[model samples]
Target: MAIALSQLIAETDQLLDAARFNDYCPNGLQVEGRPYVSKIVSGVTASQALVDAAIEAEADVLLVHHGYFWKGENPCVTGMKQRRLKALLDNDISLVAYHLPLDVHAELGNNVQLAKRLGWSIEGGLEADNPRSVGLVGAPAQVQTPQELAAQLALALGREPLLIAGSQPVRRLAWCTGAAQGYIDKALAAGVDAFITGEVSEPTVHFARENDITFIAAGHHATERYGVQALGEYLARHFAIAHEFIDCANPV
Candidate 1:
């Protein structure tokens, strides 16, 4: 089955409430392609490798969590940017992406999906007062030490997370996927026993130690693999169109 490109984009934007997010990049339809879409390929990022894989998959639209024209990026379409855009244009493939919207969506968002995968039950947003808080506070099925939680993260994400152990075992936990180490302060305010995010900064270790909160830095790419896939499957089921999620592996 096939759906009009406009319809697909509209549905996705509406479902994700893309307009609500103040994101670093545009939330939907970064690149336009054919009038209709029959096969969709979703990935974490629209890197050249993923673009090549999407082309090989014969995808009419490339759906992703990360897309081009990010804020503060050079506007010039040269070098790496030129090659990626040219490939998509030559193949007539549309590029659609969602950033913060995908992270905060109640059902298909990265945060919710990560919770589902790791057996954590979400209690509330990390910022208790903010309804649209990207980070979430939660608890595992059982209380776990930093090391045990690290092991589970390693098994679930296929990458060993960098753990800064705390004195207390993790009872209440907070997590926001993909370079959300900055939210540790918010997590601390939430009074969680531990915090988890992708890509730790140098200051994060000190904060965790001083605050007595366990910190886990799971790989950015590793932790974010599920939301786009879930969105792809939902699209496939909703429109009765073919959808494939291609993981172009990245360590960071």
Candidate 2:
């Protein structure tokens, strides 16, 4: 039971509406491989370890949230990049990636999936002006104190979040996953009681303090591990393929 690689990629592109996004890297089918895909391994990033794991799983496709050839990364076919690409090519496994599209998809997205796991009810986009905003404003099932929220995140993500105990949830919060610390301002604009993101800068402390809002810095890898897995499961169920989520953990 398998599907054509081209068909799988095409369906994913449409499902995630990848063409609508202005992403740093290409959205779908970053590396071409065999014509058919029977097994897929999904993960947060397409690192060497993940590729090795995919090869061990006999995966025909490596689908991930992060892929190579970023907007300003060193464009050289040497060293680590060379090794990774060589391995994928040698194994004849396709690499499919979705960056911003995976984050913003209404269903099977990082934001939505994270919320589903944490029992957070999404209200709207972080940016009031843009409905397609990647960051999300939402509320947990129950209004919780900063400590309670931190505990919840820790339990759910398997990593303790860096909690700035200040404002307690008054039924609303905002969040964006994977190194979106810069979007703190956008979250503030959403007027949330707390802001949750993968990482935080020094200035984020001042902003959270000054504005009486809580801040939680959950691990980037932890926060973003769900979207690709969700996508992979969906693909597997639809196409009669095998899917496994490979977690090559990064503490960051």
Candidate 3:
């Protein structure tokens, strides 16, 4: 009923090909707790609220898309960080996270999962030359106006997206989940009628207008809630362990 924590981490690392990505934060086990794991709580981010939820759920491991020790973050454990880490340590719950690796994985990645939910058929990567590109180029089952696409996103994500309408109808679309407005140029180069991401910058509107491509800014947390859940389910089935996905709502 329980598997060794080291084995779980090793299997997950290989499953997501974690080491292949030069991620912003460290992947795999960020905080070690018990030697074995029987239950896992998966979420979009390892926030304080999520940590508390995991503790309440009596989880042995907290699996997340975002974890601690970012590339440029303050190394010191203090303030908010101190409290969050303290809670996990006190509860004896190991923390495991995967960033870009979770975004680009073919089956369980955020982009692919979003496409599956929205009924979009993925044609290829947004950057056709790059095998590791996180953004994807795809199309819905039917052609739709920018407004219609926005409505579909709002309905599916349970959050209304900010729409920057363009002159053309959306026949082809490009998308990258979670703060990927910066990939708009790559989307444009792909000749898609619209680009979708979790957040939009001020200049994103201008680019969409001048380039005649629609832009949609869905919520970052809303857009990326699926991958970690899928990964958790996989681990549970593979190891015969229990998994629960806890959604700690974030309006952003």
Per lDDT, the best of the predicted structures is: 3
**Which residue runs does candidate 1 get wrong by more than 4 Å?**
none
Which pairs of residues collide in model 3? Answer: none
TM-score of each: 0.99, 0.97, 0.99
* Every candidate's CA RMSD: 0.7, 1.0, 0.7
> TM-score for model 2?
0.97
**Cα lDDT of model 3 overall?**
0.94
Give the alpha carbon lDDT tens digit for every residue of 1-252 in model 3: 999999999989998998888889999999999999999999999999999999999999999998999998899999999999999999899999999999999999999999999999999999899999899998998999999999999999999999999988899999999999999999988999999999989998888888888999998999999999999999999999999999999988
After TM-score superposition, what is the CA distance of residue 86 in candidate 3 from its true location, in Å?
Answer: 0.7
Q: Per-model C-alpha lDDT, please? A: 0.94, 0.91, 0.94
- For candidate 1, what is the lDDT? 0.94
The alpha-carbon lDDT assigned to residue 92 of candidate 3 equals 92
Better structure of 1 and 3 per lDDT = 3
Please say which candidate is ahead in lDDT: 2 or 3.
Answer: 3
